[model samples]
Structure formats: structure tokens, C-alpha cells
Target: MKSFAEIRRIAIARKGEHELAARMPGPPERPLRDLSDDRVLAEFSRRIFQTGLSWKVVDGKWPGFEAAFHRFDIARNAMMSDDDLDAHLRDTGIVRHGAKILSVRDNAIFLGDLARAHGSAARFLADWPATDAMGLYDLLGRCGARLGGMTGPYALRVLGYDGPLLSKSVVAALNMAGALDGAATSKAARVRAQEAFNTWHEESGVPYAVISRTLALAVPD
Candidate 1:
């Protein structure tokens, strides 16, 4: 794998320092350990709903979603009644896709289990090693509802877990760097991708999230 410095240099050259600095994923606004479980579920729901959809439209209706979901209180959602679901389908406040709506309850139940084991889902997420991003990805896919593909990773970053996102451009840059081949849609490819990012992070002490964005920026539009 190429050093993060080389990749970042390429990104800076392509995007310029000003834009790069402006756009890079920075440290979490609040410490991850302190993040509320409700907010964590909210992010998961947001990413799930946003997949293959217009993010702008989701953002616009987020208030309604928040209200409908009671700000994503974990216990409340984990116990969603069929009647509540039927009501959500009839409500115009949020996207009413049955499966996606069901994911909210499922993920909440998942989080509730995490809290039972870890005391809080926040601690479990905040304490996970970012170097093991692939492990995290695998765990979410195995356990969390509808968190396969890019959904879990996107939600993780938004939840303040600093890790690489296998976005299209980032995947292209990984292939270019010989760290990955074809799409990183399989488990082995994801492991290879994580190994590459771990090497870059160890070599340069840069956060995986920034490295991911840098790699994407390295690729021209």
C-alpha cells in the first residue's frame, strides 16, 4: 500500500490545500463515548433511509422522522408495535417504505442488545479499534439489520467512528494503489482494503477517515 503522505499529496495537488482542509472529515464534534444512544440510532436510520435516495429530501423531512420516531429513543423503538408501524405507513412525515421503516425497530433492538452487554452502545462503538474497520463492518453486517454494504460504514463515521469509507472514488484509488482489485464488495476485498489503510495509518499517523477522503480526492472527477 502507498503511504498516506503520497496519497494526501496527490489529493492536495488535485483539490488544493484550501479545499482539502475545508472538506476533510475532522474530529468528532462530541467525544464518541459521550454520544447518546438515541443519536446513534438516528444516524443508523438516516443512513439506511438515505441509501439510493436523495439525501436532501431526507434531511428536509428529518424533523418529521424525529418526531415520528420519538427522537429515536432506543427502548421505545426497540419495542415498536405493529399498530405503530401501520401508523407510520399512513403518516406522510417520513419515508414510509415498509422494510426501511422496520429497520428502525430492528436496529433499535440490536442497539438495545449492545447496551445490555456493553452498558451503552456508545461505549461499544467508541472503544472499537478503528484499525479493525473491516471487523466492525463484518460485525454490523452479521448482527445489525439492513447495515450491509456501505450503510454501516456511513453510519459509523457519522456516529464519530473514524474509519475509511469505501466510496466509489476511494475504491478506485485503492485499486490504483494496488491495495484492492475490482470493487471491495466482498469480505476478502474489505480485509485487503483495511490492511492497506492500517499500513498507511501506521506509517503516517493519519486518521483513516481523512485518508479515505484523501484517496477519493486523489481521483479526479
Candidate 2:
């Protein structure tokens, strides 16, 4: 694999120094102490809902979603009846996809379970080792509904966690480095990608989020 310095250099060359600085994922703006499970659930819900649809559409209706889902209160959402979720299907204010709407309820249960086990879902996530982000990703897939693929990691990033986001650009950079082939969705490919990132993190001491973004920057737009 190419060194992160090489990747950063290429990124800075391609995007220019100023733009590159602007593009870096950076550290979380707010303190993690202030974040709550409800916010984490909300962000995860947003990321899952955005899949296979225009993000602009999801962002536009997020306020409606917050209202409809009772601001993502974990216990309240888990307690929502089938009839309550069904109402969202007929509600024009939100995306009417049945499975996606129902996923919210399922996710609430998932978070509630995590909360019961780990004091809170946010605490579980916070305690998860950043170096083993893939482990957390795997756990999310096994435990949470619709959290597989990129949803879990993307959700972590959205919730201000400094974790890697394995976007196509990052995948392309990995492919170029011979760490992955084809899509990085398969188990073997994912394992290889995780190993590569882990090695890079150990070598450079750069946070996974920055390493991921730097790798993505190395690839052409």
C-alpha cells in the first residue's frame, strides 16, 4: 500500500492545498460528552434512509422525520406499534418506503438492546476501539437492522465519530494499492481493507477518518 504521505501529496496536488484542507474530515467539532443516544439513532436513521435515494430528499424531510419518530427517543420509538409505522407510509411528509420506515422501529429496538447492555448505545460506540473500526462495523451488521454495507461507518462519521468511511473513492485507492479487488463489500475484501487500514494507522498514527479521506483524495474525482 502507498504511504499516507504519498496519498496526501497526491490529494494536495490534485485538489490544491486550500481545497485539500477544506476537504479533510477533521476532528469532531463538538465534544462527545454532549452527544446522546437519541442523536446517534437519528443520524443512523438518516444514513440508512438516504441509501438508494437522493440525500437532498432525505435532508429536506428530516424535520418531518424527527416529528414523526418522536425525535428518535429510543424507548418511545421501540414502543411504536405497527399501526404507527404504517401511518408513515401514507404520510407525504416522509419517505414512504415501507421497509425503510419499519427499519426505524427495528433500529430503535437494536439501540434499546445496546443501551440495556452497555448503559447506552452511545457509550458502546464510544468504548469501541477506533483501531478496530471494522469490528464495530461487523457488530453493527449482526446486531442492527439495515446497518450493514456502509451504513454503520457512515453513521458513526455523521454522528461526529472519527471513524473511517469506506466510500468508493477510498475503495479505489485501496484497489490501486493492491489491498482490495473489485467491490470491497465481500467479507474477504473487507477483511483485507481493514487489515490495510489498521497497518496504516499503526504506521502513521493518523486517525482512521483522516486516513480514509486522504486515500479518497488520492483518487481522481
Clashes of each: 0, 0
Off by over 4 Å in 1: none
What RMSD value applies to candidate 2? 1.7
lDDT of 2 by residue, 70-135 (tens): 999998888878789778888898999888887788889998888898888887787787777888
Off by over 4 Å in 2: none
- TM-scores for all candidates: the values are 0.96, 0.92
lDDT of each: 0.91, 0.84
TM-score of 1: 0.96
Strongest candidate by lDDT: 1
Model 2 pairs whose backbones collide: none
